[model samples]
Target: MSTLLLRLAAPMQSWGISSKFNRRTTNMEPTRSGVIGMLAAAMGMSREDSLDVFNPLRFGVRIDQPGTMNRDFQVVYQNPDDILPTWLTYRYYLEDAVFLAGLEGPSGFLAELEAALMHPVYPLALGRRSCPPAEPLVLGIRDVDLLTALRQEEWQASSWYQRKAKWQNITSLEIVRDASPDESGYAVRDVPESFSQKRRLYRFRNVIREQVFLDQLVSSENTENEQGTPKEHDPMELLEDDDVSIKSQNQ
Candidate 1:
């Protein structure tokens, strides 16, 4: 199976948790159900459409920039009047966040999704309709699996953000991915079953969390053979074998 890559960078993104009445809260990371919904929208699938196509896919994400949280107060009333009672709602968002998301599936299915995203039937958004992504969200397909692709993908943090990170000496990024049956991981109720408006259903999915040290990006451009041509190699083979490396206590 191959992987489809996405650069989910936007001024504002909000992957809301389960319905929380008037207080619509958001998860720290992009949720599996939220990403599935975005893809369904790109293919012009209605809210009542089934999400069987996504069942075979493995999802993963890396946080390039963990943006700060924000909140907004909104008035839901269509028309304002003294006769009608005032109604209000609160929504949360992650400002200036950048995320790299990967979806692993059959080569053919991933290709189909890539094409659909490039020429989306409906408008594509990072999370909500109001929060549209920057142009060209699709980052093409990768030949490797989901986890490895995310581990080797280039850093997508904004230039200013990178500069800010320098002051703090930040050198690692967090990765969250679907865990296999044998792997022990925490559970989050984020798998979408039915997207029907009347009944938005979800199931728990186990996920593994780890941090990868990003001292520098590893790419073919920087790696060359004796002939001066580009050389391709599996980055994970060159990196550590452990799930993740711990930061030094001295640092």
Candidate 2:
């Protein structure tokens, strides 16, 4: 089997499994249904199209950079006639997160997907329309099984994160993978049943959470700040500043 790799990095991403009307939630990692939907969109498939072709492919995700989770409060007008009544909603997202996603399947099918991702017929989003992915989404194809590719591939965290790690003198990374029925795994209701917006559906899949260490680290010396200068000595300071800004806006 051949595995197709994708770099899922964005400023904000949301992978909702059982999100309801007032409270939209997100998983710590990418979901299988979300990834398959992205692929279908890249292939120019309609929401009503059959997803059987992609269902057989084994899927997995590696948490290279588990960014911070943030929540946004929104007010939706319940009645346009009277703006006094509003619906309060809370949406959750992963900020500055990076994930390594893999799909193992027939070589020809995966090759087709790789081509489509490189030159997609439709714009691709991480999990929601507002969450547009960064460039270089297609990481290329690997000649390995799903789990093997997920475990062997190098860390795919963002450059800024790599620099932060180096400044902190940190090493190693962790990853998670989809598991078979026979293996020790947890069941998640993320498998796709139908992509139809009017009648959304989903099933369950087994996932194995594993923590692997990566001694090999990518050089972050070339990483530069916004002004093209070397990054600050303390990355947490910058992170704190961001937090303050976000909190002020929310207030």
Q: Who wins the lDDT comparison?
A: 1
The sequence of per-residue lDDT tens digits that candidate 2 reaches over residues 27-104 is 988999999989899999998988899888999888888999999989988776775688899999999888889999
Evaluated at residue 189, the lDDT of candidate 2 is 96
- Residues 91-188 of candidate 1 have per-residue lDDT tens digits of 99999888889999999999999998988899888778888886437878999998888888777677678779889999899999999889999999
Error of 2 at 135 (Å): 1.4
Candidate 2's TM-score: 0.82
Query: How well does each candidate superpose onto the true structure, as a TM-score?
Result: 0.83, 0.82
Residue 179: error of model 2 in Å?
A: 0.7
**Residue 175 local lDDT, model 2:** 64
Give the top-scoring candidate (TM-score). 1
